[model samples]
Target: MQQKIAVLGPGSWGTALAKSLVENGHDVRLWSHKEEPVQEINNKHTNEAYLKGIELPKELKATSNMAEAVADVDAVLFVVPTKAIRSVAKQLVAVLETKPVIIHASKGFEQETHKRISEILEEEIPSEKRQNVVVLSGPSHAEELAVRDITTVTAACEDLEQAKYVQDLFMNDYFRIYTNTDVLGVETGAALKNIIALGSGAIHGLGFGDNAKAALMTRGLAEISRLGVAMGADPLTFIGLSGVGDLIVTCTSVHSRNWRAGDLLGKGHNLDEILENMGMIVEGVSTTKAAYELAQDLNVDMPITETIYNVIYKGQDVKEAVRQLMLREGRSE
Candidate 1:
């Protein structure tokens, strides 16, 4: 069945999802904050800044007007950054005439509140105007998905029927969707894995071979699972797509902004320089701070996350941090 879907955000992920929806035969309206990208997507069918070489579906229309985008849409996919979720949700409240299946593809926490993206959405968007929220996350990257690479992700919602509806809406030959009821586990895994990806990039940037990278990834997963369990998430979810799956892809892929930023840091560039150079949100940077705070509050011993926090926020040298990490007291795995 064909439906009208509005993709809020014209970033790489948003554009790729819009393209997928268009391929699935839905009417897609991609919303961009800026006029230039909106005009480019509308007139030229491409988003050069995010997806440089890929061409968007010409049928994927874009607009800057919030009212027009949400008007009568069957579903609204929030693809914006975590920091922007509250503001966007407020905007949606103003224009949304009917309750739509609200789905978010963003993967990060609110730095100020240390709340997950779904939590922020629920807090900002009134329950009367929005249905139960769904989170779409996993190992998929925008660049790979835009080119129709085989990708799998999970759709998590408290409501199984709603999750299955989303599963049917997005499932295709190139993109596979799995449904889960563990929203807490899925969202926590999605947010925390970016920190591990940053660590992975740093390991590679420091000229460490696969052995070191593998160690970091393994240890990183352990700590992530620890934190997730403390926060009421399923322990097994850490081994699943949103957990180890996302950690592997984001840490290893050049398409990951977090890993790229960490790579730059490993190569001796500062965080400010990295952010300026990339011109895109390296979610792990902010997420590192939030996760660090959460770990401290929860009394979770996340040494890797602590090291990343110090390296990024405390002006600690990457090499020195790694040395300190290696010198820590041994523990049984």
Candidate 2:
């Protein structure tokens, strides 16, 4: 059965997902806040600014008008950045008429409030205007998925039926979707892994070998699990696709913006310069600040996260930060 889906935000990930839905035989309306991308996506069947050289599905439509994109859609998938989710949700509720299932692929906590994307949606989108809120996450990347490279992700909602519906909507020959009930774990793993990816990239930038990167990732997972479990997430979900899987891919892959940004930092570039150079959102930078605060508030022991926070925020030398981490009091693993 075909469904009318609206994908908000036309960045690399959003455009790729919209194209995938169009190929899956569904009516997809991709919304962009900027008119340039909208015109490019609709007129040229390409989003050259973001996807660069990748052609989009001809059937996919792009709009700058929020209402126009979401009108009569069976589901509205928010693919905007974490900071924009609340503002976008406010705009959505103002225009949304149908009680479509709300899904979000964006990962990160609200900077000021530390709320999840689903929580922001729940508070902004009136209950009468939507069904269960679902979070779609995993190790997948936009660049790879845009080119039809095999990818898999998790669709998590407390409501099993809603999760299965999203699974069916996105599953294809190259893209596979799994259902999980641990929304807390899925969201936590999705947001926190970017920080680790940044650290991994920094390790590479500093000319460290595989052993160093491996240690950072292994201990990074421990920190992520500690914070997540303290917040009431299922411990098992940390090892699943959104957890260990996302950590490996984002930390190791060159395609990750967070990793790339961290790599620049590791090579001795300043945070502002690295972000300006990337010309895209480096989620881990903001995530590091937010996670640091959250860990402090929750009294969770996250040495790696604390170290990265010092490098990015406290102006500590990256090499010195790594040294401090190595010198920490050792405990049995």
Candidate 3:
């Protein structure tokens, strides 16, 4: 059953998802602020700016106007970064018609406010207007998905029926979707894995072998689980595709911007420098601050995240951060 779908935010991941939906036979429309990317997708059937070399379907349409995109859409999938969700939602105030079930593909919690994307949507989109809100997350790399890889994920929402509906939209031969009731765990798992990916990149930058990177990834999952469970996230969800599965993919895959950003930062580059050099939005940088603060507030021991925060924010040395973690009071795992 193909439904009219509007994917808000035309970043790489957003565009990739648009491609997937179009291929899956949905009436897909993409809206981006930038004209070049949209024009590229519209005129040439390729998103050269983002997913270079991969040609999108001619059926997929691109527009700069939100009014045109959201008109009678079945679902409004939010794919923008955490920092931009509120502002974008505010902009959608005039254009949104029925608040078609929001399926947020971006991962990460908001800074200071400590709100998830679902929370932000609930507050922004009115109750009467809202459709089912679902979060689709897992170890999915947009680059891989654009090429039609077998990517599996969890569609989670407070409402079970809502999760199943969203699963119906994105699930296909190449793209598989599972349903989970723990939206907090699914969202947290998606958000938190990037932090570990950063740690992996830091080790990679320092010329460390697989063993060091492996340690960071595993222990990183532990820290994420501790805080996520404390916050009412399902403990088992952390072990699923959105948890350990995502950690493995993001940490090792060069396609992940989070790990790549950390790689540059680990090699003596600052946050500003890394962003400028990478020329992309690395969600981990902001989420690192949020998670660091979250750990402090919740009294959760997230040593790996704390170390990355120090390296990125407090101008601490990466080697020193590693040494401190190594020398920490040892206990049984």
Candidate 1 TM-score over all chains jointly: 0.99
Candidate 1 lDDT score at position 304 = 96
lDDT of 1 at 315: 94
Tens digit of per-residue lDDT, candidate 2, span 35-85: 999898889999987798998888999999999999999999999999999
* Residue 111, candidate 2: alpha-carbon lDDT: 93
Q: What's model 3's TM-score?
A: 0.97
For model 1, residues 26-113, the per-residue Cα lDDT tens digits are 9999998899999999899889999999988888899999999989999999999999999999998988998999999998889878
Error of 3 at 222 (Å): 0.4
| Winner of 2 and 3 under lDDT | 2
Clashing pairs in 2: none
lDDT of each: 0.93, 0.93, 0.88
Range of the 10 consecutive residues with the lowest summed lDDT in candidate 3: 90-99
lDDT of 2: 0.93
Clashing pairs in 3: none
Supply the TM-score for candidate 2. 0.99
Better of 1 and 3 by lDDT: 1
lDDT value for model 3: 0.88
